[model samples]
Target: MVFSKKRSFTMLAALLMVSLLLSACSGSKTDSSTAAETDKASDSKTLTIMAETSSHADAFKSIIPDFEEKYGVKVNVVEMPYDQYQQHLKLKFISDQAEFDLAYVPIGWVPEFQLADYITPIATEQAKLDELELDDFPGIDNAYFGADKQLYFLPYMNETHGILYRTDLFEDAAEKKAFQDKYGYELQPPQTMQQYKDIAEFFTRPDENLYGVTLMGENSILSGFGFYNRLFNYGGDLYDSNYKQQFNNEAGLNALNDFKELFQYASPAAKQYGWSDASSEFLQGRSAMAEMATTVAQMAQDPNQSTIVGKVGFTAIPANDANTSDIKRFYLPYGFVMTKNSDNQEAAFQWLEFATSQEMMEKAAPVGNIPARTSALTGKLASEYSFYKPHADIMNSFRLETLPLIPEGSTITGEILPNAVVKYMFGERSAEDALKEAATEFDELMKSRGY
Candidate 1:
């Protein structure tokens, strides 16, 4: 769908932040020591960078020839799956024998990497710092900083969530009129939770071979967090300010109940669905709507992948209150960092800067990944790329929120929260009972870790 007024503000804020950062970069000069070091780069130095196996990996690989040609250095690019990457990185760092100079890491893993001393903190050298202004990459800078506020890693890409709907199903004037008449409101995309539910219910006709919604509901850590997104937006959070888990409270109960209620209108196989299953359902036209990442927007519109190519529309996650003018959304950053135990610190820093550079992001944009740099959001790369517009539009529409900045966040959300949600969703226990138990377990876990 077309971007709304709310999205315009988001775009402005992102652009303003980028402008401020670029101005700072222009004013700062590299220190002479760094300039001398950069000048002395010998052809013998070989830089190795570890990257995740994603759609963007090839785009990253595509730039190595240019990098090597310009710097007169040989580069080795290694790709690993997400699950094994962490273990391999830990072993390499603990033994102080890492083969790679740099590696890609999720922002959520920054704290763990920092505590394990797996990443080297960026040098304080004026020239090196000047090369890529921290201000330009505020999200990454914030993620890299420790509790005491020191920079450790750099961000390469930023990701967010949005809604995907079928325009063709609701395109007929008579059908639209009928929907509005039945629902007592226009049949447009929902702006609030009530509206979201209303729309889902309206589209649901299980016996007629159509379902209202499809979700990533397979029993996993992701399912729990996905449930939390809805719970928190409805004014409930997993924990209170005092570190007590509060999902058993009124807000949490209502949130869980609302989700459980929605399942009646979903596909029978939804319980088995993950990202692949949900996307396939939406693309194949078995479902009317899906809550998904920006990365999936184009896939839903592809003729080869979908039966409804020209009929897809987009919007941010529905709000809980229709009248609320501002909708807050979450932004997730994916990027790279240097381990503290690296044998070649200088090479790591150079490679880190190279991977996160605006120039490199611009080169990588054509391969279906969004760049973290603000400058990469518009112009030739955006216009030339097929899926850029929908993702950019969604990003521009919502205020970005991040997960709570706590050390035990992974364990608490990954292991503890999912068990509690499943019990509640399946009616094994009341929301109150499940959440109360989850809170106690989570608090104990955190306490044992000295949180």
Candidate 2:
């Protein structure tokens, strides 16, 4: 069924806002009232930006003065908590007097927004697109494009899930010797799901207050993503071309069972862990490895925040046997959407181009926004960090077809499928039963939506 966009956005936003800093704008000398005094009075426009109160929001605020000064415009940034950001925007879009010109959109919400005519194509202006260096943002543009093949959003944060492990733990003399004696292979970052499991099992030592992996086992977004990362590698898909559920098949069963096995090697609180707890486990040196968003790479190396300094390593998630060539992983893109109902589309597009440019991306990286551009990954600062290049590589190699592109995508990803994972993980149902129930629920949902 069509998910209540208001409610679904609230839930998804809450989960994502945890790592964000809820701060207001710190720069910008130009206020909305002074728009006409800055430059050509007739060309000046007051643009209001509605974005989630996050690190990216903070970065956007920091750069406002630059844009306002250069373009002779005023930007009023209205930051909302994650839970209210989407609902607030939706309400504004449907109103007779919609106030926002630009919005920070999560990729999963793109289809619903486009279908409701809440957002307009960012690429409709070809000259603007070329000037923004849109081609530099590899593996992200298509995710924001509408069904008509028009780009509707610009990439802000480009994230992919991967293995973050302790380099020291993997290279330890004693641990390496023991691992080789048992598994008959060099102890290193995993290259296959089977090897990943074996390493997790080998490293587990609850008595020493250490766990092999830090799994996001909560019933929210992260856990669901964990399942998808494995599900894709194992050749399981959420739905087939006909929009029929396919996750109840053999590949699905194997993926779910393998995911369950991981919990046994994870932290004791893994069932309650979301993205933060999982990453914190690795940062605190309580977990030897973690499968999480690449955004945490810089955080995991900050000496003030992490104990694992100079010791973290990253790699793409391993593939299952049959699909070695089709490595599937999550690509959660955060981007900017220009509202179709706005009065100042041109000004908003200018702000969007500046906010998502290579310069802004590089500046935003230290604050938590993963760079969506290819140049940022190979740039000086990114090159200094061992983790950035590999993460960039993984993002480039992601299977574009893995995530569901339907209008009900958010509901399925952020709610329905995740509920089934909780049931199966808690042993309340078998893999077969859990997926079967999920398939039935999805089928009914699609039918009710007139799919």
* Among all candidates shown, the one with the greatest TM-score: 2
The sequence of per-residue lDDT tens digits that candidate 2 reaches over residues 344-449 is: 8889888878877888778767766677777877786676678888887776565654256667887788778888888999989888898889888998999999
Enumerate residue pairs that collide in model 2: 1-445
Candidate 2: stretches off by over 4 Å = 1-44, 140-147
Candidate 1 lDDT over 1-451, as tens digits, reads 6878889899999999999897576322224223423433543377666766666566676777877787766666666666666677677677876655677766767777787766767766667878876666535546656656667767777777767888877677886898888988888777888888888888888887888887766766556656676776766676777887767677777777777777777897886677788888888888888877765665664577778776677676766775333444566777777766556677667666776687887876655567777777665676554445655655565555555556577677766878777787777888889888887898788789876
lDDT of 1: 0.70
TM-score per candidate, chains pooled: 0.81, 0.86
Predicted model with the maximum lDDT = 2
**lDDT of candidates 1 onward, in order:** 0.70, 0.77
| Residue 350 displacement (Å), model 1 | 3.4
Show pairs that collide, candidate 1.
1-314, 7-397, 31-127, 118-339, 119-339, 119-340, 120-339, 120-340, 192-319, 193-319
